[model samples]
Target chain A: AQTIHQWPVAEIKAVGSPLSLGCTIKGKSSPNLYWYWQATGGTLQQLFYSITVGQVESVVQLNLSASRPKDDQFILSTEKLLLSHSGFYLCAWTTNSDYTFGSGTRLLVI
Target chain B: AQSVTQPDARVTVSEGASLQLRCKYSSSVTPYLFWYVQYPRQGLQLLLKYYSGDPVVQGVNGFEAEFSKSNSSFHLRKASVHWSDSAVYFCAVSYRGSALGRLHFGAGTQLIVIP
Candidate 1:
């Protein structure tokens, strides 16, 4: 069984502030990692995905960037936050036969 | 681009009653479809999935879904509903062979079970 961990359950950021959200996976080998954003009343959209270490592809960029620094560690970051950057951010990983998601971080940018 | 649609934003059902929630999807190939449940203020949990073979798949908690290729739909059904079954259910699809097998999720339908 694999587990995904995400930190800072909720966040409130001001405009132009830096942001970082982290996710770590357990019990997997070279798994595919993903980042998803769920905006208010909006569907879940794939933000990024990484197949291996040090490689990530952005599906939809909303001034946000993702990095897979290690095999089990994936991070979502932003240099500056905009009001539109607020939403529920989810970190997920896929094993050969299953998919699992972290608790998610809810960001509210004022 | 693969997409999924969960038509019912909200559905209310009585406990011990059978329940069904509709989900429609768009994909070029036979996409990997999934059903996930989200409790209030909680992250999403995978309830079941469909890869290939059987059109009808059984899932956790007495829940099952049938894939209708002609209808492009995967509707979840439960024999008996419980109050704990109330949650937001999301339908998702993913490309099978892509390196980036990203799961495209639906807007999600909130199911409310009344006792």
Candidate 2:
């Protein structure tokens, strides 16, 4: 079975501070990866997607960038966080028919 | 543009009652449709999917959804609702033969099951 693990289950950071969130896929290689952001009680917005290592596409620009450094590793980060950046971050990978989501990481920018 | 619309933001139902959550989509052609459930503060779980086949598709926990091509709608239904079924449900659509599998999600509908 495939599993996705996201790091720093939750984070509370100060505005303008650097932020890094990661997602690692186990038991799958070269899978299409995606990053999504959800407000406290809002729908999800696709932030970025990567088809292969070192190639990421930005869907909605929220001052965030993503990178797939390795075949199974995806990283979402920013040089400085903004108060508006606080939300739930989700990582997902897709098979031919459906996508599987990770547990996700909660972020709070104060 | 491909998109999904979930009309209800919140729905309340008595436990063991029949349940239906409506979804409508706008796309040039019939896309891959799906329903997903999310427990509070958790990632989503696939409830059901409709690609190409019978209009009705069965999913986990005795849940099912009917895809209507003419109406451009995919509505989720359950025979009986449990208190544990209280959660937010999302409708998603993906383009046919999309290798990237990028999905467009609807504004989720929160289901409140009263026991």
Candidate 3:
């Protein structure tokens, strides 16, 4: 069975603090990975997507960067967290058509 | 460019009543359609999908959606609702054919099942 796991289910930090969110997919190899952000009560916005290890494409600019160091691991990070960055972050993996999403990480920037 | 539209921001319905959520889409070509449900604070779960076929697809929990290319609409339906069915429903479209593609999601409709 395929499963997607996200680390640090929730986070609270200062405005300038650094942040890192991770996602991993098990039982699937070389799958496409994507990052999405959703506001408290808004629709989802695509951030970045990776087709393979060491290659990622940015769909939008939100002052965030993503990396796929391993085939099944994706990391989203930033040097400074802004108040506007507080929301729900989700990771998704897809190959053919159907996309499966991770549980998500809730971040609150104080 | 592809986009999805879900007109209703929120819907309130009584338990045991039939449900309908409307969706409209715009794409240059035929796309893969899907319905997903999200709990209060959880990831999205696929309710059903429409690739290319009978125009009506059945999903889990007795949920179904009809696809109409002429109207560019995909409407979700349920025979009866339960209190546990209260959640946010989203309609998405993808244009990838045997390849990698990003999903375009609608604003989403919040379903409130009143007991």
Top candidate by lDDT: 2
Candidate 1 Cα RMSD (Å): 1.3
Each prediction's DockQ? 0.78, 0.80, 0.74
Q: Give model 1's docking category.
A: medium
List, in order, the clash count of every candidate structure: 0, 0, 0
Model 2 lDDT on a 0 to 1 scale: 0.94
| Candidate 3: residue A30 Cα off by (Å) | 0.3
lDDT per residue for candidate 1 within B1-115, as digits (tens), equals 6678888899999999999999999876888889999887788898899999999999999999999999999999999999999999999888777667778889999999999
| TM-score of chain B taken alone, every candidate | 0.96, 0.97, 0.96
lDDT of 3 by residue, B73-111 (tens): 999999999999999999999885634478888999999
lDDT tens digits by residue: candidate 2, A43-68: 99999999899999999999999999
Residues A21-96, candidate 1: write the lDDT tens digits.
9999989989899999999666788899999999999999799999999999999999999999888999998876
Clashing pairs in 1: none
Judging by TM-score, tell me the better candidate of 1 and 2.
Answer: 2
lDDT of model 3, residue B95 = 88
Which stretches in model 1 have alpha-carbon errors above 4 Å? none
User: What is the DockQ ranking, best to worst?
Assistant: 2, 1, 3
Measured by DockQ, the strongest candidate is 2
| TM-scores of all candidate predictions against the true structure | 0.95, 0.98, 0.98
Off by over 4 Å in 3: B98-100
Candidate 3 docks at the CAPRI level of medium
